[model samples]
Target: MDLADDALRDRARRAGIAPDWTDVTGQARSVAPETLERLLALIGADEPAASVPPLVTGMVRQAIPLPSEAGTGAAVLVLESGERAEITVHPGDDGRCWVPPIDRPGYHRLQLHDREITLAVAPPRCFSLDEVARGGRMWGLAAQIYGLRRPGDGGIGDSRGIAELARAAGRAGADALALSPTHALFTAEPERFGPYSPSSRLFLNPLQADPAALFGQGRVAAAIRTAGVAEAMRRCEAAVLIDWPEAAQAKLALFRALFDGFDAAAEAGGGLAEDFAGFVRAGGALLQDHARFEALQAARLAADPADRDWRRWPAALRDPAGATVAAFAAAQDREIRFHLFLQWLADRAFAAAQAEARSAGLRIGLIADLAVGMDATGSHAWSRPSDVLGGASIGSPPDAFNADGQNWTLAAISPRAMVETGFAPFLDTLRATLRHAGGIRIDHVMGLARLWLVPDGMAPTEGAYLTYPAEDLLRLVALESHRHRA
Candidate 1:
């Protein structure tokens, strides 16, 4: 390579793009110059003026060096618990000063003279299995949530089935019950059924909700009879292979019946209705956005099947913050509430399963599985486009098993956006996965360090390894693991 090419590769390397890598076959691969340039532009790797990043992360009692400009400023450390610690920036002989050591592990703040940056203090490591099992090795069972069987599940698995499995496993001396991803999938097109390619990792798949978990079995029985799907449910249970579309339709119909008279029950007050209200209140805008997207997608699909992807929708409706979306949400108020009700039921159902597991003598109870990516046309992409790579697909490079490489067609979290947005998106996703679980299993955990990203219309083999803020993300995971004890 010439000097110019070497210089270009150096720039790419400094920007966290791997200009060269070693494949599984022990062969060295150099990224094409044109490809590196394109990826650099796509990732916005142009160097910015020296400044504090949105987040700084380190282990508890580990002193972290700040940006050059921030090293000499007067700083105050603010703990997450509303307490303030007066600390000074201690400059070293090398000129860079270190933030005072934080003894606590949490999302604290460092108030400097010019800027305030979030200090994510993480424990030394994640919660250890030894702590949960009390120094003994413990075993657990893994399950696919959809394939589980129980009476009255409308032909597919539901949270009630999972609860039963947990109880059984706990009795058998299992310490954990790991399960497949419960991430939300498309309710508009039930045929697109895959756990990994989800609509939103922030929410649960409502189809797996067990109404009887929250409402009584009597209410569920009445709703099933009222929806007139009793015979259909029986046939679904009798099927050899799961008919995902039919099962989803049946489950939606049952949920619809329960939602029909929900207003009356909510008005009656002091029961599931009050609990649902509390849920909606706690859910806030994020929940509202998901519900609105669900309702809007279903409506558009009903009008014209071609209107599947939100990107193709009208310019006004394409923007979640636009007036058109507000108008649509206002018009479809009840429809939006129906989606919210589904989420509430799903959340309650999963909570019940975890409760049953822990009560049945399991040390860890349930360990949730977090998918690496979401569908590009899904709710998360529609609502928060900036949080993900806009036109790229996350995939794997060529290896012994796949010579041509593999494109997963899943959207990836944008590394640049994570730093620019203070890692809010990643933190939200991590917390959501750990919400009701004793632990979490991250699919493709290697993605935290780097990912193979194929730009739209590009061959998978043409993709390059895009580096991520591995240390910062790991520290965030450790912080959340301690927070949730997961």
Candidate 2:
């Protein structure tokens, strides 16, 4: 190979793009040079400079090594509890300066010179199943969220059904109820109903939100009747196979009617309205991004049915923070608020379900299943495109289950972006899953270490495995799991 070719391979290797991989058939194959180049460009791989990283992670009570340059700087350790300590970075036996062990397992800030870095101190391991069940063995059941049924679910399973199941399962002595992915999906394209291919892992499927839980059942029934979905909902419940597009439409119409009532209530001022305001406040920018994306996608689809994908929208609208998007949001303020209401209802319903399970004497309550990746055209990619691989899809090589191979058409998180952003995207996704659950079952858990990435529009056989910062990710997961006691 030429020197330039050699350098390219070196850069690819440093970026964690595997030069070769073994297939499911136990055959070794090498990634093509062009394939490597494409993957590398998608990630925009740039090695971090010689400095303290955006974030540092280590176990509690374990001394952490600091960069040699950090030795000369004044280090101030700010604990999460508002306490502060001035510490010295002394060299260890290996001749590297190490910060003193932190006693707490929490995210603390370390100020060194002009740079402030986050210290993510994790527990040694995750909360074990033994701690959850407190017995020799534990048993639980798993269900698809959409397949769950309850009276007047609007032709699809809703969080109210989950609450009902949780109560029944707890009464039956089940310790946990595992759920399928509840991640948000495309509101404009209801036919795309795969739960695993979500719009954003940081948000819930608003379609599954059951307003009946918040609004009294009587009020919800009135809304459903007024929305004229009562007949369709009954048919959906009786159908052998779900009519996703129809059911989703019915559910959304019902939600809109409920949202109208909610807005009216909010204007009058009450505790529930304040609670919703608090939810919106806590949601911060992330929540606004998701809600805005939902509203914008719907608006785009209205103008042209084929314009649902944000990437194909006007360039100005493609950027979440662009002027066009801001103007669109301003013009459609009520539409955006309607989407926000959906999320608010979903959040409250899920939280209530978990609470009911726990109150019914189930120890673990719920184990939320987290999807492996997000849809390429979804909210996460639209709001923070750099945080994910743009021109790649997550998939697997030829395996026993599928001889032709499989292309999930899902976006993988960009490893470089994770480091540059201090793993904020990863942490947000994890925290979202753990928000109202006792535990989380990470789909394709192997993706934590590495993922098989297929170039967009390329055959899965042409894909290569991309390595991740597994150690750091696992540490974060353990820390979160311990915090949630899951």
Candidate 3:
């Protein structure tokens, strides 16, 4: 390698970029210098020789590196239970603090002088099968949530279908049901239908909602006829492969009709009106941003078909919290509310499915699948731009199977931003996936350690590894797992 190449590689290495990696077959390979340059550029590293600062910085960012061995320090430790005490750490001691043993496990706070940091005190391990089953072996069924079909499912498999399937599985002695990622997908572009690439892991796919759950079967049938898509719906349901676009259109039409009816009933003080209001209130800003994005994308597409990607959207409208978005939401209130209503229905259906599974005697009723990352053009990235990296994609290094490597085209969370936010985005994602589910299966769990990040429009092999706060993330996961009994 020449001087410039060496410089670029050195800079990349300093930034936690892996220049060489061992593949699945244990074969080592070195990445090209050009790849490293491209990746560094995408991450806004224009100066190759520039120094990279510590990921966590600022006054509120000090961390007490919690090693197995203890250290001496005078600090005030605040337990999660609101109990506080002054303590002095001793060198070479076991993992015990100076205060009384913390029985309740959760994230607490530590104040040393003028600095304060988060202290995650977790149990030795998460709840295990050995404790739950008492040495008994348990078997369960894994299912694709969208592929579960039932009569009158409006061409797309839904949570109602899963609930019915759960009943059957329970009767056949199944104690658990693992499901595919039910993460939210693009409502505006149904062609981008992939369970692994979701718009937001925090929300459920509105398309997977069973209209019958909210609107009665009779009402759904009437709406289908009113929308004049009965034939299309029938064709979608009977097709061997899922005709996503056709099915999505038909289901969306039906949802629109359902929304109209719901709105009328809500105005007339219907029984579910208050519940819907409460759900909206609970969803808060996150739900509002998603709904607003969907509405804006729809409007933009209607005007110009090329306006699908939010990144290319007009400057003012791009920011979710900007005045432009606020004005748009104000003018398109009904449209935004419609999207919110869809989420409410989806949430109800999924919760009902989990309830059905548990009621049918399943111990681990619903196991949720959490995707590794979100699509770059999707709602989560659009809403939390600060939390996600721009102009970069999460991918894998070249392996024996594909010497070219793999590009997932998904945006990864920025470690620097994660630290600044105290891992709020990560915690929210975990909590959302755990909601209404007995357990969660993390896709690409290895990503917690390090991720291969490729520059936008570059080949997968043209990328480098970026380390994450794995220890902190694992501690949070363990705490959440114990709390959820997952």
Instruction: List TM-score per model, in order.
Output: 0.96, 0.96, 0.88
Per-candidate alpha-carbon RMSD to the true structure:
1.7, 1.8, 4.6
Runs of candidate 2 with Cα error greater than 4 angstroms are 1-4, 46-50, 69-73, 91-96
Taking the tens digit of each residue's C-alpha lDDT, what string does model 2 give over 1-486?
678778887888988898878877689877888889898878777644535578888889999876666554458999999899998667767766687899899999988777788899998899999886567677788898877877788657878788788888878888898999899888889999899999999999877877767888898899998899889888888888889999898888888888888898788889889999999999999999999999988878888897867887778988898898899899999998988888899899889888887897778888999999999899999999989888989998889998877899999898777877889999999999999999999999999999999998789888888999999999999999998898
Q: How many clashes in each structure?
A: 0, 0, 0
Q: How displaced is residue 387 in candidate 1, in Å?
A: 0.4
TM-score, structure 3 vs. true: 0.88
Candidate 1: Cα lDDT at 470: 93
Best of the two (1, 3) by TM-score: 1
**Residue lDDT tens for model 3, 1-486:** 789878877887776677787777797878788777766665555433312211211111222343322334787878778898886644435553332344567777766555566666666666676666788877789999767976677667999988888899889888789999899998988998899999888898989988788777899999988888899888888888888988899999999998888898898776689889999999999999999988998899899988888999888988999999999999999999999999999998888889999998788888999999999888988898888888888988777777889998888887656666777888889999998888889999998889998887788867778878787678778778888998
Candidate 3 global CA lDDT score: 0.80
Query: Considering lDDT, where higher is better, how would the candidates rank from best to worst?
Result: 1, 2, 3
Location of the lowest summed lDDT over 10 successive residues in candidate 2: 44-53
Candidate 3 ranges beyond 4 A from true positions = 1-10, 23-27, 41-76, 88-101, 111-115, 268-271
Ten-residue segment with the worst summed lDDT in candidate 3? 50-59
